[model samples]
Target: PDPTRAESKTVKTTCPYCGVGCGVLATLTDTPTGPQVTVKGDPDHPANKGRLCSKGSALAETLSLDGRLLHPTISGAQASWESALSQVASRFKQTIEAHGPDSVAFYVSGQLLTEDYYVANKLMKGFIGSANIDTNSRLCMASSVAGHKRAFGTDTVPGQYEDLEQADLIVLVGSNLAWCHPVLYQRIAAAKSARPAMKIINIDPRRTASSDLADLHLALTPGSDVALFNHLLTTIHEMGAVDSAFVAQHVDGFDAALSAASSGEVQATGLSANELAEFTRAWIGTEKVVTIYSQGVNQSTSGSDKVNAILNCHLATGRIGRPGMGPFSVTGQPNAMGGREVGGLANMMACHLDLENAGHRATVRDFWQAPTLPEAAGLKAVDMFRAVGDGRIKALWVMCTNPVVSMPEADRVKAAIANCDFVVVSDMYGDTDTAKLADIVLPATGWGEKTGTVTNSERCISRQRPFLPAPGTARHDWDVLAEVGRRMGWQAEFAYESPAEILREYATLSGLAAQHGKDFDISALSDLTEVEYDALPPQHWPLTKERRGGRFFADGRFFTPSGRANMLPLHHRAPAKPADATHPFILNTGRIRDQWHTMSRSGLAPRLNQHMAEPYLEIHPTDATTLGLQAADLAEVSSAHGRAILRVLLSDKVKPGAVFAPMHWTSQLSSAGRIDAVVAAEVDPVSGQPESKATPVAITKLPAR
Candidate 1:
């Protein structure tokens, strides 16, 4: 403890960037100037053994206290935690009492830990008696959740990350894994190098960097994924690739699904007959295949149907729940799966239970000792903001997310939040687009200073252990939420002191859900002591006595009441707003190689910013020429919702009539690089997930200013 002496220790934790959930070993050294941190990949972790991507490797740079929110604030004035908490609690109570519980809402995030999400869900749904709680995760994977529940009778991922490497043919539909989830891409790249016979198929509207590793790149029409997959299913049937025994015993609605597949219009996919034949032949001939999709599939008007179409082929051929095959939805955030497990979505109950089910509501209410619970689903992301805009929602609390920058129709969402009666934002930074409009801004502990659990996309539960001291007066999200709950009169239910206690409670409650035949049982860890919880390693879900860790449904047994999976009969549906003469181009928005959503943490790293310094629209060279735009030229992209001025990067990576732009820039980072402001708010009818990818847009070169 000598002054000016360097002291160092390593702490094991999980990377907070993406769903790959690579483990990190952060070494914190106290120097004369301040404490410094350096991180490396953890070799023991199964997700990515000693693999750190550009974002993960640069995590230490983002942990500084330069721009962090260190204390609570009320109406832009510095205030004590007591005053802020009391104001938030009293205002919410007043609003609910005045206009009923439906008038108050909690908009959370997938970035939150499971303990934090659990407390927020309990306080809002169990005690407050409102179902108007939703997460930004509703933007990323709600379609996958809806599709999983429709097909398997539960939100279950049937395979693990190992299946990506084990499969002979890996199909990437609407996912650019090389840039988005780099660690998993590296794993697949290594596996392909080791086994040259392993083939990759990238199906997307644009040829991304991931296509470099692909044996086939299908630049199909945007929003026509259902047609492509339906054609593949038809080929599977005609080629006699169907596992008749598996279908007869384990699947329902095969005949109807096949009939729908037979009637699908493959020409809608925008691929030649030869190309379709090649794709179908490879897919149907390969016994071991994995179809992995991401935001491109989930951020569409027909997202749920697209997901079901892919699952239809897998269920028909029995290419799922095994070592080398399945339909995998790679989540965009680190804790999206964790949010799903704790019922962070508006339409879900805790532990994969149904919100609309009376039995599920009674069980959760009784377990939490709550006075009441909602009997119906609440407003999703798109509708939630609409409610706030039109005076239906009075009080709103946004936690661990920047919806103003990330949500579809973001400009309108920003306006709604600005006009809300009461708003609270719990975040590390106070100047985010969403936080700037809050009535109360609370300081929450960030990555290196918070301890809790997160579940990865493959259902692996892992620990995020604290390695640094909490900066200033910042507190953990779960701690702040529990204090609010207690302040609002639910003292006993909100009396948790640590994240360990909250996790224990949640795990025990999962036992009740499991008894109801749910697929999210983790009761084996319910009795973990403090020491045991601190030392918990990464483990897969279904962590019970009978099944500790493995893939699901390999035995042909599903979680449905009929004990069988349902293959839905699906048809091709175009985007909500197709390109017309007024807006003659399709605007596609997604992540870049070195940035995370909104760039709150990742933007702090200079090296990461050096990779892609500013936002630029990727337009095909032919289209750029037609529009009289040059590389580095400023172009105004406008939709019916809003508009943004972006620098042009002409490339044929995109089709002639389509353009691509990264969705990471915000008002603080750039003057006019907020791309989501230009996205429309159309959502899938079933899942309520916004169509972030297929916005009809018009682009023009900006005149010199």
Candidate 2:
């Protein structure tokens, strides 16, 4: 119904889906059914100029409390908040007392807001005395984090989203930006349309929808990115694109890096020599080039090395930290960057602090007044579950993520959670794969019902303001963590009355980090009142009184201890497991245009589900013919770990020996397809992110009953 401005409320928030973090104006108005909220893109926001993708456009459909876990549950029975919080604190305390503090671990998620992540990290690492706090982001961007640290001496992204527009060339390797990050893709498409001289390169084993815009498509082998990039490094040198002055001034280990990357061939990539030569010439000739990569580059055994291989080319030519050239890792989550800022990973501390550094640890310890901080890094995601299976971790608290359907070797992950002594899950829905096995379940607020700040891929901090009322008995995830902290005896530190208070403390800690010479400093925001936080604009980071609204490394200064970036020598390494005689086809998993990871909340949206009605495996026509499989045939895909039955989708996009499947369906949503079941748990050695892209599996036609 049409109403006056005072009658209707419009609150500004950030999109909770992908890392594009587009600003949304949610207008609440009275409808016949009820007070319905309508979401529209905020034109005033810079990340996106009044543009939203299909998933973001259909967010209102997923906001209903139809399947919500409105109240806390203990052992399948509804319980009061007091009893639930006390039981959680008591069980965790018992487990830690009987075993060491490492016996209890908090496995969190990238879906969580920054405030939710900060409180969870503080409770686990500061009060509970264990570093076994890892987020689901481990499976996504951990390799990129390790690579950024190795190259920049810290985890920092040098380029902003505007770089995509200013670049003369954009190289997309192992990323399908058209579907996963459509808003950003729209921006690039608009930029290319206006310039007409801008070129795009899509490199992957399969030709996806994203390839439609590419001037050149390199359909290389599944795990051959390192070889292709190393060859690019050599090409940069051979073409005299090397910036000798910049390298000598701001980089180290040039000779060793070139020596290691000196040997590379095009044939190894399974690409024609002409194709390789064309890409190399464009990369070398373009002074303004940006290489964008995603999970496909970060989900291999050599994921870190693959990142370094890309960075090597940029660093060799000094193409980074400039207006339109650099290596950009477009993250997979809305607040994956924010999670990094709060040190949500097991190996990191808050404010981009190092977990292994004693001085940094001392700083966090002194700041939080934490008496029992772990001295070293703890188990990553895969190892954390392995420890759970082996009885090393007695109590496990999972928040906001569905690992049973999302984790590789997910059948084993489910079994491990089933065998564990105590499991607590906090989420909006109670029927998720992980929540079913949970001993205690706590209802948490959803996107439009929660208020906090989230940092996007460009280090732009935006507010996720709550415009709707919290449904039923659901509580904010951060408030739940703080109440648990109070029950566990840290009332002084976790005594935040609102998310703004937690944000203030987090910003104050960043000020402490600046004292130690860290790159992350938004301390100027520490003095924001509650009103200011509610009205917080989308501001890029490194904002301070001394230096305001500036990009990093433009003046030839780095955050490394010696003020020089390190160039690491990297070698190509094959995936941990290759396709064998029994498992002849390589199974690659990714998202479709619509559906998200495991389809927890997204599956509820009918419009989104209409895009992908069911789960199906996309196999090349040749492979389908070889296996006597036809379109609409049900096929069972199996690996050494597990099996999944899927309807067949014959496509020419994938190579002959490869098949593709969406990583959205779970047992709850579809009985025939669970992609993670067939995925191996083999992780990148440095980053511990599982190889979800290149799992070898055998496909066969499933006979009727």
Candidate 3:
């Protein structure tokens, strides 16, 4: 090999896995034969400061040509893009004509770029005039959105990551930050090291690795968050910690909320008075408290209520808008926040806009230049699957996510997809359980091979630039969708030459939002050329130059017409279906330290496999003893929805009536290890997020053979 003509270039990009959205520097090296790309953290990005977690670091390995969907595949054969697009459009048209707009649904994902999400949302909710489009975000942070809306009158994150460092008290509620959000955890850890007096609290049922950093750990029972938060409110009020002036000026319904919080019924939520008082006292004593929460709070049947219960305490004390004092929802995916910004969720319109308001709807319709728009909120995740299963939805298009392995009542989801008249799957890998059932498979660009932007948990937007050519015949998701749109008679709007162009248009859309008073406005980049877009640096939202480092609700002005927040009164409710005598154990599902969802990428790494390589149930030793079970004992867990078998690990981490299982593995990984198979489809009424955390089940020790 010769080194005379060697060259190199660096591309700024963002991580594609978790919501930390660490900025990446992709270096392409030119050799005598060919070019090779390598990745590392971008030092200037605020989220990570040049550091990356395992998933983001190993992203390059997963973008291989092996098992890649090379072309538009229909009925197990390769086809032209034109033919595939024509078939999809014609079929969708015929299906709508035969069964109605409700007969079809678009199931998209947070992994999609804001541009892709915007177009899909427009097509399904505007052109198609069907309120049946939803995204994988429903399974992640829909509850947080609902909670923010109820408490603040808008879906807004009021603080920046710097708040985590500046806080005197940091509370990790129902989140495993150490494992799931490693980069953010590192920041908190570094902050603690720098300021030894800063206190940390971990509030969760399981004593996870994240608890290692906690000064105090509240191992509260599952579904008891509302009570604990309510008790905190009562204590704050009694201690005179309430910001009376701020509350009076910017809030309403505090009396009813306070009355409900102080009621005796709160004690029945499995928290003792003493514990609640201690937690509340700590919160009141601290001037700056940042409470971070995730799926553990959002995956419950009363998920939205739990979110408000937490936010209510912050608002009552007027702890928001100031440094180190606010409610922070740590998102599960890298672009989950971006998805919301672009109105990717089923119930929302574009640019943090509302769907129900006639004016908001009219504005978005006019912005998109759409023919028509859906008049109401769309069907959510669970409802979309229910519609498909009931035959109300004739066709379904799923992108980026694997519902068959990840959704609640996933077996039924698989069955529904299999039975649907038409099912289209767009993915990077070809062999996922969901993709196997596709009537058509469109290969999508993976992390290092795609270019776009993703917003992290803190609302920071970072660019994702391709380091190398797309593997095999895999295409960018926006290109594929746009091609299909063109075939469907949407010519000019979908005619984009590059992701850079699409991003410029998306930025312009955000600019349009600025004229309408939405805080998510990104008008600062509306003038960027293609070269500038490709070379754009990482930045946070509310991207107008005037508001850099400014968190939301700083002026105590909410998005409601009254410009005031609402303290929604909430009542505690148990899981929709509690464990019974027949199915007597509560099953909790979650992620492990070193694995990604459904083992699509993480499973490819042998080193990543060392941590809990197999699926096993973590049951209390006492429960295992009563059930004649021991560590590594084969056991069968059965629920009303389905059944699965796994090895049992008797541990004290779980309560006697409760069990825990990691949600990453699938049926392909282990014959009987798919936990979602045994999970129920119960969902929160307000958030539409499934109750994956608490499912009733029965466990029996199986014979060794």
Candidate 4:
């Protein structure tokens, strides 16, 4: 070993944790012992110029080998890769042969790179000929996808990050950007400071720190967003702000949509007419309004309808695809957009192609050179678990996410995995709730040690390069899956020496689909060699050599059959579970400023824990008084699905009938703080996204017993 002073080098990569997609400058240094990495913000990156949030900033610290699954372990014993791969393939093959294609499933993650998502989707949908593949993103942003598909003719985000700064009015509906999307929120705050005339509106039920910056904070009732937006639509039209020419030329279904948004119908939405009038006037009066929404609007029974209602206003005013206009869905995961581009969702095929369409399926099958492709839509998040619970899915391959802790009715999900015939988990960390149930564990590389590309919420695709060698026997996720594919008898197709090679192949497939009118075409990178792919600069897609970075829908050309966006008619629907006489309080779940989902990485940082040390229920002061509970008093919140005991934080932030809980903690952190355990498994019918945000529960002061 070399005993002299170690050398250090910097590697550029994208953050793997969140959708902020901050670029990192990873510095690898050789000490007397071994190599270490120090991560800093990439000042030149467009998303977060010279800034990283707490989670992104601590990337290096989370790269250690602590509790890392180093090699394949079967039945708690070390196993050869040969044996492991063979067993996985043979068992899957046998299961499919005996029980049919739908009997097997692949549950993947948002943390995986685009190449990884592509390979997993290919294995299940292309090789296995089953659409039983779904990602953890199903839990996060599926509603946004369904909503965008209905309104935009494609699951496309119509604006760029620059629109946030350029907008005269930026309304954050059901999103806590300051905490969840820290860098983006910082950009908006800076933009507001520079332009004092700009207005900021926060429309969440909780008065979070993000609301501190809002010029108008509407602490509206829980699950009342669709109603709020529908009222705004009616008011906007009444104020004569409708762009009739644009409506006639570029959109359809407005007549029914308008009728649905009228005063009489919107009055049942629980919002005061005066408040609705003011909000509508402000939105329509401001020419450049960028309305940003997230999980709040998307994670509901009427999630798609909520999304359509918001888009209806923007479409009526012809306000989309221009500077400071359009309805933007800020994704929760870093590669959520990339996953969408690669069609990681169950109902989608590669390159924004739909699985239900025969033509799209044929094109994707031809592009992959795949012998056969799954022609029908697969089970989504909730349904996938239900299938497993019902004994229909015998084998499941879970990658990079702990659904046991994150999914609603999580305890039942854990039981379903436990009852499955075979379960394989691939992850860097070994102690996750999902990993605890695995029959085999495959070690995979993490953030600074892996290389791939990730698309952010803005659709910017940037390269994520490896700064350090793979620790222990851990390999790249795509390599592991590809190796398994080869063992499964798809040798030639799965052969790839490196991630860059896999990406090049994926790019070629995307280019072939680009000939069609899909939004995720990457024809520009079709000619890139492995070296070129590895060194590829940041670029946005629909990327052609001729056109580089730009916003979508600028020309008003949509991917729909009519080449126009659709005005989906939507009416207000209450949350699946609303506060009632028996369950007299509404429980709203969301992310806190410090931690990410499941507390896998963010929980590693002690400073991050200081924000809100543990799980506590936030209730209105009046409700606390009515329930005979005081601040810091223990209260038991129970729903039809499960129950949990949480400490109370009485505040005026919540409405009289509502309570708030952070969605990050799990049983690993606290014995009685698994919020998802208590949350009902009600999901959006169209999107399959669980309504983790709102659940009806009764709260009472805990007895001394």
Top lDDT model: 1
In candidate 3, which residue pairs clash? 131-378
| Best prediction by TM-score | 1
Give the winner by TM-score: 1 or 3: 1
Q: Report lDDT (Cα) of residue 169, candidate 1.
A: 97
The TM-score obtained by model 4 is 0.97
Per-candidate TM vs. native?
Answer: 0.99, 0.98, 0.97, 0.97
lDDT tens digits by residue: candidate 2, 6-105: 3568998999989889999899876555687788898988888799999888887788888899899999899999999999998998888899899999
The list of candidate 3 runs beyond 4 A from truth reads 1-7, 30-37
Model 2 misplaced regions, further than 4 Å: 1-6
Question: Model 2, residue 468: displacement in angstroms?
Answer: 1.2
Q: How accurate locally, in lDDT, is each candidate?
A: 0.94, 0.90, 0.85, 0.85
What overall lDDT, based on C-alpha atoms, would model 1 receive against the true structure?
0.94
RMSD of each: 0.9, 1.5, 1.7, 1.7
Weakest 10 consecutive residues of candidate 1 by summed lDDT = 353-362
Residue 641 CA displacement from its true place in model 1, Å: 0.9
> Could you tell me how far off, in angstroms, the CA of residue 531 lies in candidate 1 after the best superposition?
0.6
Candidate 2, residue 568: the lDDT equals 84
Residues forming the 10-long window of minimal summed lDDT in candidate 3: 264-273
Worst 10 residues of 4 by lDDT: 263-272
**Candidate 1 lDDT tens digits, 440-533:** 9999999999999999989999999999889889999999999999989989999999999999999999999998889999999899999999
Full-model lDDT, candidate 2: 0.90
